[model samples]
Target: MRRRAIPLLVAAVALAAAALTAPAATADEGAAPAATATDAAAPAAGADDRHRPRLYTPAANPEAYSQALDLARAGLYRDAAGILAMVRTPQAVWFGDQSPAEVEREARQVVRDAAGATVVFSLYNVPGRDCSGYSGGGANTTAEYQAWIDAVARGIGRSEAIVILETDSLALIPSDCGQDDAQGTKTAARYAEVNYAIDRLEPLKGTKVYLDTGHAAWHGPASITPRLVKGGIAKATGFFTNVSNYQTDSANSWFGKLVSACVAYVGEGGDAAQCPHQSWPREQADAWIAANVRTPSYQWKHFVTDSSRNGQGPWVPPPGKYTDPQDWCNPPNRGLGARPTLNTGDPLHDARLWIKISGESDGLCLRGTPGPEDPERGMVDPKAGDWFREQALELVRLANPPILPGS
Candidate 1:
C-alpha cells in the first residue's frame, strides 16, 4: 500500500471515500460482506512455470482480498492471491495519515469482514526501518516500536496472516539513521524487537512469516548473511529479498543464489579454502560446506521478487550523461509487475509479486516532484491508472507467460 500522507487539501477521492464508503457493522452483529463468485478467473499455469505456489492470506485485510478478487475476476487469480498474506491498511498508518477515530472503527469492521483471509503484514514504523526516504519512517524508541508490533499482532489475532516483518531494517543497521547514537545497544534492540514480533506473530497456527532481505542491489551475498542473522532470519520460516521494488528476474535470481551460498559459507565460518565461488577442487566444495552452510538454527525460505513495476526492469541510466533513472524511488512510466502469487521458478525465489502497486507514487523525491512524475507525458504523478495498465500489459508480453489451457 502507498504510504504518503495525502495533504489535508484532501483530494475529492479521500473525502468521498470517507463520506460514502458503506458504513461497517458494530461488534455484536456485523453485516456479512458480499462474496465474489467461487469460480474466479485465473490464468492457466505456464507450461514450464509450474512452480506456482500460493500465498495464504487472512481476511484481516479486506483491501488485499478485494485486490485478489479483482485479479481473479480479471483472469489473473493465479497471480493474485499467490503471495502469502498481503497487508490491507495498518491501523497506525490509517490513524497517522488520515483519521484516528475513523481508522480505529473501520479497522475492527474490516477485521470482521475479513474472517478467512490469509494476510501478509508489514510493520512500517520500526525504529530504524529505512535509513532515509522512499522507505523511511519508524518509531523513535524501541519500546514504542514494540508497542506498535504488539498492536499489529493483536490485530492479527488468530487470523492466518503472513507477516513481512519490517523492511530494510537489516540494510539500515550500519546506516546513519541514528543507529550509532547508542552504539550496539540500539542496534541489538532493533533485532530484539523484530524477534519479539516474529515470536508473537508466528505462534498462531495459520501464520507463516518471513523477514526482509534488502534488494539484490542493496546487499551482497556475504554482506547480507550476518545482517539476516541479526534481523532474526533463523527464527522465521524464511526471509524475502525483493519486496515492493524492481529488479529483473535474472538479477534477483543471481542475487538469491549468492545470498543462499553466503549464508551457508558464514554458518560454517569464513574458510575460503572450503567455500568456492568458482570452479574449484571437490575438496574445496566439501571444505566450504563444512566451514559454512551448516547451521542447525534454521532452514530459511525460498526468495520472492516484486514483479511489480519491473515490466521495464530497473530504471536504466541514460548514456554517460545520466540525468536521472527515476527508478530509485517511483518512476512514472512504470507499471505493475506480476500480481502477488506463489509461482516463481527458482525454489529459492518463492513468489513473483506486486509487492508495490503500480499506480501509487512513492511520494516526493529528495527534490520536489513525486518520484513517479513524467514531465514528457504531462503526467506529474501516480494518480492516473494509464501508466500502470500500459506497464502491466507490456510485462505480460515480456514474460510471455503461458496462458492456461482455457482463459
Candidate 2:
C-alpha cells in the first residue's frame, strides 16, 4: 500500500518567509544561458557511462538534476556527481493517466529514445488500486485496464523492453488486506487483467514481462506462487520482488529463489501446499528444492529484485517511540542499494538490481501518528513522487558499494 503523509502548512509558511528575506537574482542565477550557434559549443560534460548497463533514461528529473548541478558548481563534487549518476540509471516510466493514443505515443518515444538499450516500463492501472487508499486511482474497470495495457503494448511495438506488470495487483489481494473488492469481481478479474497483459506483451519480440510478487518481507513463496500461477506467470518472462520497498538483497534473492522453486514445483504437478516457506531454515529450504524441484534454476521462473533503497537495510525506529512505526515510509538513514546491472552471475537471478522506484522521490511517511507532521521525524514528508532533497542527499552519501568517482 502507498504511504500517507500529513500536510505541513507550518513548514510551507516558514519556507515562504525565508524566500521573501533572501536576495533577489536573475532567472538564470547559477548557470548561464545556452550558447547561440555563433558561439562555439562547449565540450559535452563527461559521464561514466561505459561500465553502466544501458537503462532507459527519463527525459530529465528537472528539480533533482538542477539541485545536483547547483551543488557541483558549489564544489560539492561528490554529492553533485552522486545525484547525476542516479539520473543515468534506468528507471520505470509509469503510464497510468494517459489515453490509449497518448500512452502508445509516449511508450514508442521512450523505446525509440532508448536506442535498442533495455528499458523498464511499469503498468500500474489495476482497478481499485491500493484498496482505495493512498495511490487510490486506477482504471475504473478491468476492461479499461486491458485497453490501457493494449495501448502500451502497441506503443512498444517490437522494441526490446522489460514490462513490470501491475505492481501490488497480486500481492495486495483483498483477502490479505481485509478488502474483498481487490478481487474486483467474484470471477477475480484482477487475474484476468494480468493474464491479458501478459498475453498481449509476451509475444512482442525482445520484451520480458515480470509480474509483481510484493517483497520477501510481505509474502512467502507458498503464499505467492499460487497467485503467480493464477495470474499467468507461466506465460510471463518471470516475476519481480521488493519494488518500492527497502528489503535487503539477500532476503529478496532468497525469497525469489523460493518462489521460483515453488512455481516449478506446482508446474510439475506437485502441491504448493507442501512447499517450504521463507520462514523455513535456509538449509531446510535448499534441501527441499534439491529433492523436489527437478528443473534447473535457469529453466525455472526467473526473478528480479528492487535494490534501489536497501543498502543499509530497513530503519529501526527507536523502541517505544511510536505506537506504529510505519518503517517502510521514507524511513530515516536508509542508503542507496546496489547499482543496476544485468550481469548478476546467478542465472536464476535475471538481474542483480534495478531502480524500480525512483530514488529521488519521498514515500509519504506518517509513522502511525495523526496530524500535520510525521511524528517520528518531526517533519512533514513529501507526497509520493515528489522530489525529496534531503533523502536524495542521504542516499548518495551512504550508498552501499558507494556511488564513487567515475562509478
Candidate 3:
C-alpha cells in the first residue's frame, strides 16, 4: 500500500509538465526594470515613505519567472502570480566558497540592485557546514572562513541589508554530528568563526545580522539560547529560526519569543537553565516571561523566522514506514507559508518572514536508504541547490495564504 502511494504522489507532480519550464516574454517586456539604488535613495513619493525590502530575482530562475508570465498571458493571473510571487519577495542569497573579491563584487551588485532597499544575504561558509552530510562543503579552515566573512562585509559596504549568518552552524554542532577535527580542532573553530562574522558584520552602518537557530522542532529554547549567546547573539540584531525547514509560523514565532525572552533573561542576570521551555503551557510561559523577563520586548533580542515551506507544517512519517524517516528532508505535500513582510505585530518578532532557503531547490533525501534514491519517494531527488520543478509547483498549489488574484 505504501509503495503504491508513492507512485500516485509522483504522478500528481508529473502533471505540471513543461509548464514549469516554459519560456515567455522577458520581465522587462511587460514590466519595467526594478528601481536603481540612486532612484531608491531619493525622497519618498508619499508621507509613508520607507525603504521597501528589495527582492533580488536571480537570473538563474528565469524559467520560473518566464513560466509565470506565460500563465498570466494565458489569463491564469492567480496561478501566474502564485509562481512569480516567490521571486517577488526578498529571499536570502547565499555566499560560500567564493573568494573575498568574488563575494564582495556579488554582494555589492545585489545591494546596488536593491538600490538601498533591504536585501537578505545568507552567509553559509562555516568551517564544517552540514556536518559532512549531503549539503556538506564549507571553508577548509577557520582562517579561510573569517577571510570569507570579511570579504562579504566589505561587499555590503554600508548598504542596507539583513545578513542571515550561517544556517545550521549553531544547530548542528560538532558534538552532535561527529564532525572531524581535520584541521586539529573544528568545533571550537566553528563558534569562533560565527563570532568573527558577527563582529565584522554587525558594526556595518546599515546592516542587521541574525544568526540561525535550527528550528522549533529540533532545539528547544533552553538548549538553543546558550548556543546563540555563545555564538554572539548579543552583538547581532538577533537570531533566525526555521531556515529551510518546515515548521509552522505559530510554532516558529512562539519558539523565537521564548528564545528572545531567554536571551533577555540571561542578559539581565537571570539563568537560562531556569527559563521556560516551548513545551510549557501558554499561560505558564506568559507568567514566566512577565515575572522574569523584565526588559521590554524592543529591548530584548529580536528574531526572524523562515516561513518558506511550512504551510502544511512538518511532515509526519507513516507509522513503521521506513527505517529512517529523515522527516526534515524533502517530504511530500508541503506548501508555501506566509509571504515576506516587515510588519510582524509582535515587537520581538522582526520584519520579513523570509524564504531563507529557496523553494525552487530540492532537499536531497536519503531516508535511511542505502541507495542514492529516496526509498519513500522512489526517486533520486535533485542535488541541493538544483531546481526542483515538482516541489516548486506543489508549493504554489498549496500556498496557505492562498496565492490569489489580489493577495
Q: For every candidate structure, what is the RMSD over all alpha carbons to the true structure, in angstroms?
A: 10.6, 9.4, 8.0
Quote model 2's TM-score.
0.83
Ordering by lDDT: 3, 2, 1
lDDT measured at residue 373 in model 3 versus the true structure, 0 to 100: 82
- In order of TM-score, best first, we have 3, 2, 1
Q: Residues 112-144, candidate 3, lDDT per residue (tens digit)?
A: 776666677888788778887777888888888
Regions more than 4 Å wrong, model 2: 1-53, 73-75, 181-187
Higher lDDT: candidate 1 or 3?
3
Reference-based lDDT, each prediction:
0.48, 0.72, 0.72
Q: Clashes per prediction?
A: 31, 0, 1
Tens-place lDDT digits, model 1, residues 37-83: 01011344233423322232222333333344445446553433221
lDDT of 2 at 306: 83
- How does candidate 1 fare on TM-score? 0.63
Model 2 per-residue lDDT at 46: 61
